[model samples]
Target chain A: MVAKELVLKAELRKKLGSKHSAKVRQSGKIPAVVYGHGQEPEMLSLDEHDFVEGLHHGHRLFDVQFEGKTEKLLVKDIQYDHLGKKIIHTDLIRVDLTERVEVEAPLIFKGTPAGSHEGGLLEEHLDHLEIECTVTEIPEAIDVSVKHLGIGDSIHARDIKLPDGIKLITDPDALLISCRLPAVTAAAPAEEAAEEGEEPTSPEVITERKPKEGEEESEK
Target chain B: MALMPKRVKYRKSQRGKMRGNATRTNYVAFGEFGLQSLETKWVTGRQIEAGRVAASHFLERVGRVYIRIFPHKSITKKPLETRMGKGKAEVEQWVACVRPGTVMFEIGGVAENVAKRALARVAHKMPVKCRFVSRRHTIG
Candidate 1:
């Protein structure tokens, strides 16, 4: 489904720097920067509540209104607090609706892999794939069915069947997901030993010792 | 009784920062569920063992648990009543330097709820705050 264009009222930010940004945040607004299409970057601020609500609407493209002009923009990046509990900053890029843009579309696995039921682990190697498509053609996410995946089976980027007009930009041979046995007991020892750069000798080997003959004889 | 190096290249070493991404081993990359730290702190080997025991006991050994960080850095301390100026102290314990957003542990081959509950128990044993993160929630 095509995401509906969200319209947000923003104000041009005059002051800059971490202190000013902190003040903006304290006032319940988020500091943001908008740039793209060969235009100079614009410092802006938006209502924190509205921006977050817009994100929940699943719309990446927005029509930001400020200074008597409406600019079509895409939500390029969002920086969150270390705890990922709050948004700290945002980056928006202007884009033409008709022009193709490169973005990372999240991959959604649709079903449980057959290997998982048989004690094999299903691992998603890549969570998103880089794709090029027009703003209107951008998919909220790409679904990958894993019901048929068995142990040792893998799905590569090239193997995915994309929607019409969506072109994959990631390496065709890049692994997306795979079904395999858990590496718990099998690979951990070697990997750990290699990382430590030596065999992790047992502590008992260093601490334990046989009593000397003199002590043993005296005890007897 | 606990995990530790049988021998160390040095008795004590400097406590370093836990900077950058977890790129050393596949430990952080492959787990289906994880406990991501929200604060930076030194995690002692005993604390890690307690976490491991909590998680494994809670899961009943139905799945695998991966410890992403190891207490490789040895901290030193002086004995009680010891005077200063005797050079550095003896090795006290080993600790792993953890940073905010570091994946402390991961679990695989278990149901989402089971992993969450198990990790919650593990979190109780840790010195820092943590949250449960799953592969699905992390991919995008």
Candidate 2:
């Protein structure tokens, strides 16, 4: 569940497309679309700073105020710029507080694994977990303990312990994290030695090679 | 040794134009943090090796460094003081054509600050401007 209800005021957007979106962004607002519940999609423009700040604060459900009415909306998707740094557009879906929704929650791996002391490296394979639960019961982040991990030990999605009322939606066999020793690169020298023993051959030329001066008479 | 393809169908390749932002392999897929390029250029294998060594040395082998780019395009060069009437020069080196928005290197199994510093050291070895990025820390 969210700590508090974050309310945002939005203005209805009439114009659309890349040009207008760029203009809206230049004016410090983000263009967003709201649709769900078999209703007509409404184009809206939100305060860029408030929207981005809310996302950074991990706000999933938002109470958007538009046209003198308030609607509960869930962040469906966010389109980023080419650099994947700035948010270009946002998609929101209508939702109720009582219905269940599937969301990708961030996974926080806590505790240093005992394997690290034995010259083992801890690697994180997955950072987020897909989960389903009521909108009001959504968790901010899931914490996975790694204190028991030893060398050659790994934790998969099925091994995670979820909070009450939350159901895991990701595949059970997906690997999340693992601890292993560093790989030794001894084969590099051997590969190079083998390559040196092979005869150098010219690559295929699109145009046939011309005959050498001594081979011209023989070819004729 | 630098990252390169063991074998290739062709040795020398045409110098194609580098235009537009990278559409594939632009996001952080494997690791927690990544080094993103801001310009388009050829990243040589030697430079890639240098960056890998830099990051690995800085981390003291505690974490893993994943090189996302491989030098596949072979570059050819003529010998010094050679005549102009000869055929094409031999393959001199290999490079990876890097466009803007490409995640060149990624570091995993380390703290965020450590990853940022390691990527920063790697940025010094790259030919283009680079920035550190992480898994999109956003809720759905």
lDDT of 2 by residue, A1-220 (tens): 4563589999998888889978989999999999999999999999999988887787888899999999999998998876898888999999999989999988889999999889888988888999999888878888899999999999999999888899999999999999999886443464475568853344455455667988988878
Candidate 1 C-alpha lDDT tens digits along B11-118: 667766666533333224566788988777889988997898788779754678888888877888989998888798877777887877778899876778989999
Model 1: residues with Cα > 4 Å off, grouped in runs: A184-220, B1-10, B14-32, B56-64, B81-84, B135-140
Look at candidate 2 and give me any clashing residue pairs: none
**Model 2, residue A51: what's the lDDT?**
89
TM-score of 1: 0.81
Q: Report the CAPRI category for model 1.
A: acceptable
Worst 10 residues of 2 chain A by lDDT: A198-207
**Shift of residue A21 alpha carbon in model 1, Å:** 0.6
Candidate 1 lDDT by residue in tens digits, A1-220 = 6555988999999999999999999999999999999989999998899988877767788899999999998888887765455788999999998989888888877888898788777766788899999988877788899899999999999999998899999999999888887654543454466567884443333444669999999999
Residue pairs clashing in model 1 are: none
Indicate the worst ten consecutive residues by lDDT in candidate 1 chain B.
Answer: B20-29
